[model samples]
Target: MISSPERGGTVSTPTLRQILRDQLAPADPRILCGHDRLDVPVRWVHSSEIYEIGPLLTGGELLLTTGLGLRGLDGGTRKHYVHDLAERGVAAVAFEVGRTFDEVPDEMVRAGSAARLPIIELRSVVPFIDVCRAVNTSIAAREVDELRMRALLDDALHDDLAAGAGVAPMLGHLADLLDAPVVLVTAAGALVSAHGVDDDSAAWRVVDRAVAEVPVRSRGRSLARLVVGERAGAPTVPYAEALLRAAAGPVSVGLTRAGVRGSALAARLVEDLVDGRPLRRADLETRLAGAGVTVGGPSVLVPLAAEAPDPRMADAAVAAAAFDSMARSIVDATVYALVSVPVGGPGDVDPVERVASGLARSTGLGRTTIVVGDPVGIDRSRPGADASRTLTDSLRRCARQLGLAASAVSPAGAGRRVHTAREMLVDEAIGTLEPSVRAELSALAAPLAAHDERASTELVRTLAVHLAHGCSATRSAEVLHIGRQSLYQRLERIRVVLGFDPTEPSVYASMMVALRSLAAGA
Candidate 1:
């Protein structure tokens, strides 16, 4: 996997022949070698009279010297100089003749010829600075042109992807453009998408022998890499490294699109899974496994509900990436995540809580409530239909929790939080009571509601808020955007109408049940 020297090697720049022909040099230099081989790119023009300049150059430079180092040097030293410059990939050596020798040194020319290095003899005095200025300006112009070309290419690739062309097709197109087999592998070396490589093994072999590898990254995360040079006989791709680097943006966009599509499909499957009508066990197992949801295991489903335009998953594409391989779907404002929990695995923490926290942090979702249901273990030995019935019941529980999560989640300010349905068991129990019992409980808040309706007061809201804050007047005031005195005034009104103080610990449980029961019906 010998990577190319520079990632930006595809840029078109001024070459030695172009520099000489563009009248960038003065006093017509004599070519000591055949001028046909002058295509070496001149990255910069450096005027170094030191003989030890070989170690100083990073390569791809056109060296301009006045024969200062060649003075009193033998043939062996001169030959060493020629070979060093060639090894450094110096475009060409232009030696100014007047300062050190009357005629160009014969041994220098012969040594350059042996090394297949281009040598230019400036017979008349030449101003190294003037030549450098002209050459470097052209170099800058060519660089600008190359950058413009890369931008145009990237834009075209992005447009094609946005039009629904997938990553594989784009990679194939890139392989054609670069004239090499290309591959993209994950950080774990799994093949993500590729083109021109024969098969999976061949693709990995291409990775093993990568001639150029460009990292594909987005949103400050590295997702994968592009590997070129698939086979020994493949024509060398022009600017292979530069083209791969340019393609990184479009690659990330393509991968994001793919992830979002998978999430969207998973969401559809989840909707079906949660529906009242059960899918056959075979059909359910196939879909669940495809989405990375383990079948025949203890399953815990967590439903995350938020208001429309949830800040956490604003970009469904990013949400898809953040969830990794989890089976999650964004249905309306709620995200349903189906998790497979190992028996007695890890600590008491649920996987959904850990994942939801990360998802919230990554999406900048200020608040999220994930109501987790009891884990249901599917008996694989049972009939397929029976097993699917068990899962369907669990999913139904999941569906109900989504609604409960909305009504049950308490007012918690701005950070990652996870709440389970068990925490709201009393509320759930009250809501499920027989209609007659439910009616009696709902009556508890009727007085406050009636006062609110008649006077346009927020007595009912204040009661709920106060109860949600554990009967703390100070915290309720802060949440209600009121002063302590104003909150106390509302509390007094609530106490007068309801015939009991909501702050009494003896009646707190009854008050909570009444409020939650009313909210559940609402």
Candidate 2:
């Protein structure tokens, strides 16, 4: 953070009404339109005689002009000029009329009203340079006052720290000082604590739309970020930002002294979700914050659950690697982790693969299986219950696949221990079927099973191989070491007994699952 000359207080931006009420306002000013919006703050003062100067502006400028460019313009052109200025977010337009026109144009006034832009008519012959100087000087003075106020506030917060105040109390004090909701979110965007916020979702909303945000760091690593809202009732965002920046030093110092251990808390959070335990929104937010895993504001969560002879290998892998945000907890003999990666970042890097490799390496030359469930996309705008439900449901789904992924972890060899739930997604889905549903699917292949048992014909095996090779008669015959004509004959007899063509796409899919389910049950 840039060093401030002093610590905590705030000065509001100078508005047009405030300026007009004082001697800094231009002489002989008359409100032509938009009188109700005089509270708009002036960022800077600019004087332009060129008619097409709107595009050159960068919003919030108080445009001053002697009307030299509006002389004899057509009605449409004058309206367009007014519209251009308004659309560019100029705070207000001060038009001097004696040199170019007797009064402000009716077309311009109507356009200003239509755009909700303030138009001030200068009836006297006022020099544009003097007006710019006086207004700019006032703006600069207010900025200095704002900085001084922020320094005072910062100092007060340090005093709070000296008085044995914790982070939560300091947040409350900050909220009282600013008269707004204040929150602390981890760098990953998880809520640590909040003041003036009602619940978990509201805290996230504050983070999502925070007008002022400052990072608090210890020894060059981020500890947390301080957020302030615009609803302070009086403090502008600029002033709030200045105060927060100054406050970060004390916040960092406090966090270091408090010894915030994020990794352990994060790990516990991931385990709880997978254990099918319901967690409150506040509890969830706090734990996720501790783990440095963010589920808010465009953050996507990927849950990975693993078991191994030694879970420390997996723990070491995550601990040693450079993941932006990851939390690991060893629950029983299994380690559960929730990794956060940004959306629309490097799409080529598969998170599942990245985490799988880490786990595989951590348990090198040992028995370990890692299963990454479906990627859960968190919508921060949802209600607290809805967000919490989404997280719990996703993790539970991942938990259900643990048994299956574990069974198939060493498909290639014992060395190939890491696998994604997606590799067996179809089977994972099949495993979720109700017991009666699975029985019905298994029954579909019962006739073949019986035929093979009674006649010793190997029909079930024939059908399994045939469908597994996409109904390729030649490949089926080669694999079964049977005559081509015999394979065809058996396939025809099997179709007749099954009462449907097995090669049809939908029937093929059903039969494939049925055969697998039948084999699994057996």
Candidate 3:
């Protein structure tokens, strides 16, 4: 399921005939072979060499071939050859009428049609290169559109995170750009999000059918499907699929940042519809409710951090490698980690926190400090912005209280450490204790809370770690990324303030207790 990023999603390109039809006119473009009228986009043309083409064409191409070089060309030879192509799932067979095969033989056509294979017979002498160019040009144009759409989507989606414009409005923005209606459907083919479609429209039906066709699959369960709507007879552009796939990563990213923006927006719109407002909510509810989730309810917000800080690493490569290793490990475990820059750094605009939160619930982490706030009530919908603000404030306060540089919020059950740490931090005395030691020994170490600042905490913790490592000053210096002289100065500062040498064996026992006490208090 997880391929290289480049090959992650299939790029559907317009077929040769389809390209010609789109470029020329939507006239009576006859189907000689395959589903002629079907809008099969040409991903790319395959080489004439049989071995070379086999891998490139994956069950969908309007193969335009003139039986030029078949190893054997006897009675049933060509017929069997065409049959093989049909079995390979080529969308259509476009045989040039004037070539060696001349007109497509009735037997070949009959055999192909019997296999439900689309066949096209080129009446006029169109160059094979012309067909290739047509398809290529169409693909290039569509690629340009796709790229433009992705860029515009990223720009529009930024607001969803920053301004808290729930899922509906965000999807609406996408629909507007594509000039098509949008329907956010649930797994059982229910329409939860409807933008640009009104009641008594055939567009809704198309959306419903499409949703049934493309079931949602995320985190080992199918929860919802996204269906794009167009007019009654409008072509079912794979453009929508392209839009969905391309938009998914960033949308997921934004949703993580904003926390339940999609579900919250849907809830608000549902309430509006249920209350006899202008929107049509019941129809949407009927569609989405079948997905096995209540149309209205409370949901907790959670965030997953891709990597934790390793004080041992000094270089960027090591830090990045750590994050990548953690991300790969976690994503495989049904969790998606969003990497972020460490807090308190200048201009660290990492999207890790937001992305983690958006993909939080899917990760199935119970709850912790990483996941802040409460399960927002959805029985009667309110603006998502309010809930988001509450969550942000809660997280900010927790971070300040805990002195944590970075963290991720998961559901309460999964992120219990965060909850415990936050609970510990709320104690007034614990907040002033040496950061790590006090946090760990919050209750017992309250009496030894000599200096409250971070510098004091670091000095004590550094001295403790060094002493614990068999008093190897060199190893301690390496871990702290400081010189021996600096380490000594830090130890001296600790001795002066705390009245005990960290290096002394007799003082070690007392220091351990003090550190543990400070941690419990925190």
* Predicted structure with the largest lDDT when compared to the true one: 2
* Residue 143 lDDT, candidate 1, scale 0-100: 65
lDDT of 2 by residue, 421-508 (tens): 6755666667689999989988998898888888888777778888878788899899888989999999998898788887788788
Q: Which 10 consecutive residues of model 1 have the lowest summed lDDT?
A: 305-314
lDDT per residue for candidate 1 within 450-500, as digits (tens), equals 888899998877887788788787899998899999998888888999998
Alpha carbon lDDT of residue 112, candidate 1? 82
The local distance difference test score of model 1 is 0.65
Counting clashing residue pairs in each candidate, in order, gives 0, 13, 57
Best-to-worst order by lDDT is 2, 1, 3
Q: Each prediction's Cα RMSD?
A: 23.0, 20.2, 23.8
Error of 1 at 514 (Å): 65
Per-residue lDDT over 228-307 for candidate 3, one digit per residue giving the tens place of the 0 to 100 score: 66533444444567667655544444322322212343334322322224323344334334322343433232223221
In candidate 1, stretches whose alpha carbon ends up further than 4 angstroms from where it belongs are: 1-41, 45-60, 67-93, 98-152, 230-235, 258-326, 329-522
Which scores better on TM-score, 1 or 3? Answer: 3
Top candidate, metric TM-score: 2
